[model samples]
Target: MSNLNLSLAMGDYDRTRPIYDGRVKIDGVDPVCMLLSPEEMFFRAFRHQAFDISELSLSSYSISVARGEPHYVAVPIFLSRAFRHTSIYIRTDKGISTPADLRGRRIGIAEYQLSANVWVRGILKDEYGLGAEDIVWVRGGMNTAGRPEKIKVDLPPNVKVEEAPQGATLNAMLAAGEIDGFIGPRAPLCYDEEHPHVGRLFTDSIGAAEDYFRRTAIFPIMHVLGVRRRLADEHPWLPGALLKAFTRSKAMSDAALADTSATKVTMPFVEDNLRRARNLMGNDIWSYGVDQNRKVLETFLGYHYEQGLSPRKVDVNELFHPATLESFSL
Candidate 1:
């Protein structure tokens, strides 16, 4: 049998990729293409990169881009996690209570293109009656050293925008009263007694999603895996084998979770997390078998269009290949 080549999309999160990699080895599948971001997936798929999705009308690969297109061979395989944009945080001493209080205040974000920053800005515009012009915007770098791209948005004329160095530095700035509020992911804001200065404005992944859905009726598809559609079609048995491997790996993850001992966090914890993820996400993670996934795609497409990130509309159908449920029924 010829080896199968696959590509998976993953983020900075520690668990997802490690778990998938272990499963891939156990299942004996070979990965050929692997890009990290949903944005990159969209652009690469459009450009027909090494393993382009656009070239294959029927192949078994996973394509995670914004929600309006269909994949002939790929399937919407996972919910992954509910990623939220800014956890609007204020210093405890600032006494800012609500989103409304943030007007004219300074806000720090990781970067402009980062999904979290984009979603946060969208929420501020659609929900809080604040546009980009209403606050002082500060752009910070990522975890490692490098400057982020300058973001341009349609804000009111009064808002002043600037850039900073990093999230940790931004956190320091917040502590020093350099910024009034910080808009970033929830993980960054989870501080304890040692760093008690920050207070959460709200934990609103669902809220931001709801607002985004109300306007576009779609959820956002961030990180996704992609495969060269043509290759999978040539090897008809490839898709089923790949899906089966993932499913078995998922099952292994379950067994692993059940065996976890309190004294030591074994592979079982990872398995347990995978099992729970499967239960919570259902076929969304392995099969992409939900209408909600489509909604997310549509919403993301609209967002890109409105933001001027892309000049042309991306039809989901054109981006990925088609596959029946039975293709990933395992």
Candidate 2:
């Protein structure tokens, strides 16, 4: 019997209970600590070599794959929940009204290589003829930049990159007139309202993606759950266990959104959001199944190669094992 002590990382502890509770009951697999973010997961996975990392932020998959470390399972988590749309924030004083107005202005992003960053940039390039060379790019975190060699997209030449703490950095820079606009997931943009210095430019990522996709017919896969390769090779059952757990969690979250009980009274908006998430689980948007996930990774690799992100082309078939998808069957 495999004695697997798995450490899983997530964005929020409260939101991850579905997976935490479900995994504990799996035989031979033990879930240890549930981390709070991708950054923490990366640090712990690399910093502490004690416990084997079983699951972690999907964003970290690219890097983990590069290192050939733990077994990785590509599970779609936040993209289905969050990426249906994204928000762009700009100062009202700048008089920037549309995507076209963003030209020649400084844009703040949470990270340069984040999945959202890549999708947003791709949208700009494909729809508006904007490339990384068109705007000044300011990055929020140092580690947030993904492996350029793994996934390359063309960036504007005039881009200016910087690192700041996730929450306060963008607002501080906007208040000080350091940047003209900001692009990121909706939560950070929404949370910035507390600062009073920044204003929203656009409120929807889905709208932006829709406009872009209408023209391009291509949708970008943002984030995915990554498991280490080593652990996966040792214990094949883990990947299926993870997929089953996440699927259950997704269903529970959906049911919770539909419930009228007082416990769910505060989360009415989440119901519609959950339904949208369920719809996104379709073949086009969600890729929990193995073949579907491989296609997504291959698509990214192709984009990265065409955009000059990687030097020698990588075979998508080699990056992840085929069995990673069998978890959905469990």
Candidate 3:
């Protein structure tokens, strides 16, 4: 039988570039890979089901899974992960010194269902007793005027959410102090530009993130690799093949990043940061497989349900394909 040809779409991270450049191959498959931004890849994958395999937002995937039969099923290849402590940006003038201070404040979000926001909110609630209902949420794009949640979400009634005023954006709103703060994956443009008043809520974000990890042991997952349900069903081996290939790609990237003689990435402190991460989280810092990440997945699913993104708490087993849940050991 001939190898199956499939379309694959995901962000162009070093971990995935090996697959894009043909150094890593999916078993029994010919992949047509498209390097895309997270927004484009996710919107097309979830909303349109446009690719055979693509990167999916973990929060959005949970929502789809909770709503019943979804178009895609996920493998255990976590394409993106991060500590969301750095995601929160606040106006310095606001008296918001701690996460608890966010209560009764207006905060801007691109979308409430965003995985990063979900993690941030979960962290706030878990670490500071600040629930989603405690704040008034203003929804809009960070730089642009309007942005809709890629997957429709019906949040709990008590959780207040409002649209940004027409012709306004979260970035401008944060800069003008219209919104007390902003929380999402990417920092607001004003914060990046060093606006005097716009600064991260955690002034020492790295220190905060390190402390958070020390306490929780959760390096939050943002994106999961997904295959069309129909395709996975038709070719039972597809999901496992994807998991293998992506894991190999990540290993290659890790090896390159660890090569200190000539740093692989453009970042200045690659070796120092890599040393610190390994010292804190061990060698397999960015691990794949369900068994390795079950706790993190469980935590995110709990948050997803509590925050009203998922209709009900989704099981970690339900979030990934059975084939990916176990593997043949050497």
Candidate 4:
């Protein structure tokens, strides 16, 4: 039988490197993997269907799935995960010292539907008694001008959102205090450059993130692997095969990371960080599959619906290929 030819667009992550480099091969498939930034990959995938497989923003994907216009059938392969307590930036001079201080303040964001922003908002609401409707949102680019949301969003009537003033960017708006704070995956240039007044709401973001994880046990999923819906429908075996290859690739990555004999990665403190992460998250710290992460998915889904990103609540099983949901025990 001829092997399937498919285009897979994803990030240049350590876990996915083996798949891209051909060290890990998908069964019955010849993949043409393209390593790309999440911003570029997601936009093209969702808007143009430019690839057969791609990384999808969880928030946007959930919205599409719940609305019954799903362009992709997702797998539980979480390509990107982060604790976004550090995503929230506030003006130190504005009398804002805590998460609760964000209420009624104008918060700049690159997109109303950014996955990281969604997670941040959800965390704030769950941990600090703040919700989307509690703050005024200023929507605009992070560093560049005229940035737009990749996916369309229809916000609830109670939430107030305004477009950035003509030619304004969130980085500039936040620094100038035109907006009281900003929240997104990307840090504002002002914060990066150490602008005096721009500071993270959580000064000890890592500590805060760890505490949140301890309380909630959610690492916060950002991007999910998606296969073209039509392709998934026609080829029942494809999704499972892809998952097997990816899971194998992840195993290789984990093995390399755990091998502290002579650092396998270029990053400083790789050994120490790996040990610390394992200590906190246990073995399989970056695990994939539905059964292992149902609570995390359910929490995110609830947040998606609560924030008006998803028109209605969606179940975790509704997002992935049916074949990928379960496996047989030998």
Candidate 5:
């Protein structure tokens, strides 16, 4: 039988590199893969259903599922995960020293539905007693102007979100103190350039994240691998095939990271950082699959619904393909 051909789009991360380079192969499939930035990949995926398989934002995916209009059904393979403590940047001059101080302040966000922003808001609500309605959200591009949310959202009446001033970027608004803070997956360029007043709300983000993990054991998931719903329905085995391939690809990356002869990544102190992460989280810190990540998924779903991204709470089981949820064991 001829292998099924499909288009796959995702970020160029270590865990996915093996699949791109042919080190890993999906069973009975021939994939045409493209390495793309999240913004481009996600916008195209959610907006146009451009690829047969792609990485999708968890928050956006939840919203789609809750609305009963999901274009793609997710697999259990989590492609990106991060602690969003470092995602919040604030103007030090605004006297915003803690998460609580963000109340009543104008915060800039590229999109309210971003996974990182959702996680940050959830952390703020859960940890700092700040609700999503407490602050004003100013939405626009991070560095460009007039960026629209890839998916349209009709948030509840209580949530206050406004667009950035005409022709303004969140990066500029944040640097100029037009917005008290900014939260997204990537830091504003002004913050990266070491602008005197632009600093992280959680100055010691590592410490905060470490503490958060210790308490919650959630290294928040940002993106999930998704296959188009029609395709998944047509090929019942595709989701499981994709899951197995991604798992092996991630294992290859994990093995490379642990090799001491030479660092697989272009960073200093690979061994030390790996040891630190394992000590803090566990051996399989960046784990895939549904069973082991239920708590994390449930927490995010709760946050997603509470923040008005999802009309109703989306069950964790509804987030992934059933075939990808489990596997046979010997």
Candidate 6:
């Protein structure tokens, strides 16, 4: 049979490089892969169904599923995961030395329903007893003038969220101290330029992330591989094929990074960082597949429902294709 031709949109991470370069190939498919930014990829994918396969926001995907209007069927091959301790940045002058200090303050966010914000909010509620009603949220683009949440959000009546002032952005407002803190996947450029007043709430983000992992053991997942629902229904075998290929691609990236001769990534202390991560997270720190990451998925799903992103709590099994739930035994 002729191979399927599909468009795949994803970030150009080391783990996905092999597929991008064709060093790793997807079986039974000829992929037209384009490395795209999350903003472009998710906007196009969710708004227009622009790609056959794409990396999709976990929160947005859950919202779609819960609304009974799902356009994408996910695989367990997670494309992005991170510890979200570093997502929160606060004005040092706001008396916000601790997470609990965020209560009753105005917080700026690019989108109230972003996956990173969802994870950070969950951490705050679980660790510091804060909830949606505790703070006023300002929503706008991080840099541009206007941005909208890709999915609809039915927030609790008590949660206060307002649009940014006309012609303003969250990044600009944050720099001017118009907001007490900012929470999103990307830090404001002003913060990056070492602005005196803007600082991460967690001064020692690495240490804080380590502590979070020790307590929760969750490497918060940000993005999931999504296949168009119609395509998946037409070809029941496609999801499994895609997952196998991505898993192989990630394994190749892992093996390359673990090699001590020279370095796979252009960074200092590659070996030391790898060793540290392994020591903290075990050998398979960035693992893929359903069974191996059930706890992580379950936790994120809980937060999705709690934060009102998902109308009802989504189940881990409902998040991925049946073929991806398990693999044949060796």
lDDT of 5 at 50: 97
Count residue pairs with overlapping backbones in model 3: 0
Task: Tell me each candidate's TM-score.
Answer: 0.59, 0.72, 0.98, 0.97, 0.99, 0.99
Q: How many residue pairs collide in each prediction?
A: 32, 18, 0, 0, 0, 0
Candidate 4: list runs displaced more than 4 Å: none
**Tens-digit lDDT string for candidate 2 (1-330):** 556777666554333566666632544666775645555454455445333543443333554454444345454443232332355677667778777888888887765655556556655675568776677767653223321222223443445555454554654576666778777654453344555546665656566655654554444555555556667777776656665566666656545556645446465566566566455444234334545455455656654444434444456554545554343223
Expressed as tens digits, the lDDT of each residue in 1-330 for candidate 5 is 999999999999999999999999999899999999999999999999999999999988999999999999999889999999999999999888878899999999999999999999999999989999999999999999999998999998999999988899999988887889898999899988999999988879899999999998999999999999999999999999999999999999999999979888999999999999999999999999999999999999999999988999989999999998779999
Superposition error at 51 for model 1 (Å)? 10
Best by lDDT: 5
Which digits, one per residue and each the tens of the lDDT, describe model 3 over residues 95-123?
88988889999999999999999999999
What lDDT score belongs to each candidate, Candidate 1 first?
0.49, 0.54, 0.92, 0.90, 0.94, 0.91
**Residue runs of model 5 more than 4 Å from their true location after superposition:** none
**Residues forming the 10-long window of minimal summed lDDT in candidate 3:** 91-100
Per-residue CA lDDT of candidate 4, range 1-330, in tens?
899999999999989999999999999889988999888998898888899989899988998999999889998899999999888899999999988888899999888888998888888898889999999999988888888788898989999999998898889888888999999898899999999999999999889988887877889899999999999899988999989989999999999888878888887898888787888888889889999999999999999999998888999999999999997688
Candidate 5 lDDT trough over 10 residues, lowest sum: 172-181
Model 5 scores a C-alpha lDDT of 0.94
| Error at 21, model 5, angstroms | 0.4
Candidate 2, residue 189: lDDT? 34
lDDT of 1: 0.49
Question: Candidate 6, residues 1-330: lDDT per residue as tens digits?
Answer: 999999999999989999999999898899999999999999898899999999999888889988888899999889999899999999998789998899999999988888999999999999899997798999999889889988668898888999999999888898999999999999898899898999999999999999989988899999999999999999999999999999999999999999969887889899999999999999999999988899999998998888877889989999898888878886
Model 5 lDDT, residue 193, Cα: 97
lDDT tens digits by residue: candidate 1, 1-330: 654445544442333443445634524456543535543444445334434322221111212233323233454444233445335677667768777788878787655444555556556676677765677777664333344442233333454668675444665677677777777543343343346667667656445544554565433444443444555677555545544544455555444345545412434456566565555455334334334456565555554544444345566554433542344224
Which TM-score value belongs to model 6?
Answer: 0.99
C-alpha root-mean-square deviation, each candidate = 7.5, 5.3, 0.9, 1.1, 0.7, 0.8
